[model samples]
Target: MKYYVGIDIGGMTIKGIVLDPEGKALCEDVAVTGSERGGDAMCDVIAELVNNMLSKCGVKKKDIAIGVGCPGVIDSKNGVLVFSGNLNLRDYPLAARLHERLDVPVSITNDANAAALGEAKFGAGKNYKNRILVTLGTGVGGGIIIDGKLFEGYKSAGAEIGHMVIERHGDVCTCGRRGCFEAYCSATALVRRTRRQMEDNPRSAMWTKYTSETANGKTAFDFYHDDIDAKEVVDWYIKYLACGLANLANIFRPEIIMLGGGVSEQGDNLTVPVQTYVDKELFGGTSYAPVKIVKASLGSKAGAYGAAALVMKD
Candidate 1:
């Protein structure tokens, strides 16, 4: 059976996984990214990681192809990482360099896109022909899968869904935009809202368990059932999240939209409400085309698994 090596490069640690054509993981490992050491050093670390995985799995170099999911802008067509602020890499030919080291075919794409593909092939989106993975973390990151393939529009820079303006002139986003989806629907946004609510409502049940500084994405959810103030925060979060999801649903009309990241851990508490709002806001209504909002099953492994999927031939 042919094997594929998938590498997910992050600022802290680089995760790697070996997978078969059937999406079974043969081996999984991680190494420090050492990105501060420069792009070449990061490549060395990834090469070592691939070698270690191959050794452990008894897979020959010639029998495996390598796929990489990296943060920042990537020129996937040329296997070049155009820019990665997190990795301090720019105009780096990552795929070419790794291919030279291991003498195998290598492919690369933006990390978020890879995660979407991973879900499509092996995780939450596996059964759907069209799906999107929306990760509500520090920032809202997402990937689009259309017709069972990744849709990296216009040289792989187009899938930056977080920057989509869901609320024009509302809140400031890290991308310097006002009212972007990330500015409202991310976990960071949720924490900010939770803290603000606690500060405004001194008697909020959230304050019983967390101070303003300790308020997190789960803070409001924790007390929503019993606290009016906490429930307000949750309602606000779900409203904005549904707005963004509805915009995406109206555009792509995917079979499902999978929610990932820390906030998604709330499971039904998150999906149930957001689904209601999205269904209400759907352009042509839900009867013709329904979009199911589900939690991602792979958790942290989606990126690495998606990277491996890059090399798989259907």
Candidate 2:
């Protein structure tokens, strides 16, 4: 049976997985990114990890292909990492370097895009032909899948769903853009909004429950039912979130839009309301084409799983 190896490269850690063509993980492990050591050093570390996984599984190097899910502007067509501030990489030919060391074919993609592929193939969107994944973590990250294939835009740099502007001249995003969906929809955005509300309304129950340091994306949802201040914060967040989602739905009209990351842990609290608003504002009525909102099932492993999928057969 053919096997594949997947590497998920992050700022803090690099995760690796060995999987069968069937999408089941044979073995998986993780290691520190050691990003400060430069891209070459990082590739060496990943090669070592990949070798370890093969050794542990008694798999031969010649029998597997490698796929990488990296955080940055990945030129997947040429297997080069254009830029990744988190990894301090610039114009690095990651795939060629790994191929030199491992002697195997390698595929590369943006981490968010990999995660979206992972969910579409093996997680929440498995049943749908077209899907979009929106990860609301420290920042918003996502990808688009059409007919079960990842839709990376020109030069494999597109599918940056988070940067879509939902609010005109609204909050400033780390990307230096104003009113990006990420600026208002990310966990950082939620925490910032929650903290401001807590400070403004000293009598808010959230203050008793959490401090600025303690509050997180869940702060508003956690106290919304009982606290008017918290409720407003949550409502405000949902409004922007729905607007972004509605825009996506109107444009792509995918079968489902999956939500992942820290905030999605709210489950029904998040999906149920977001669905209501999205449906109400969707470009066309829900009768002709409907979209479903769901939570990603693969969690952190989605990137690795999706990376492995890079070489899998359809």
Clashing pairs in 1: none
Cα deviation of 274, candidate 1, in Å: 0.7
Which digits, one per residue and each the tens of the lDDT, describe model 1 over residues 44-77? 9999999999999899998999889999999999
Q: lDDT of all predictions, in order shown?
A: 0.93, 0.92
lDDT of 2 by residue, 75-114 (tens): 9999999999999989999999999999999999999998
The parts of candidate 2 lying over 4 Å away from their true place are none
Candidate 1 global CA lDDT score: 0.93
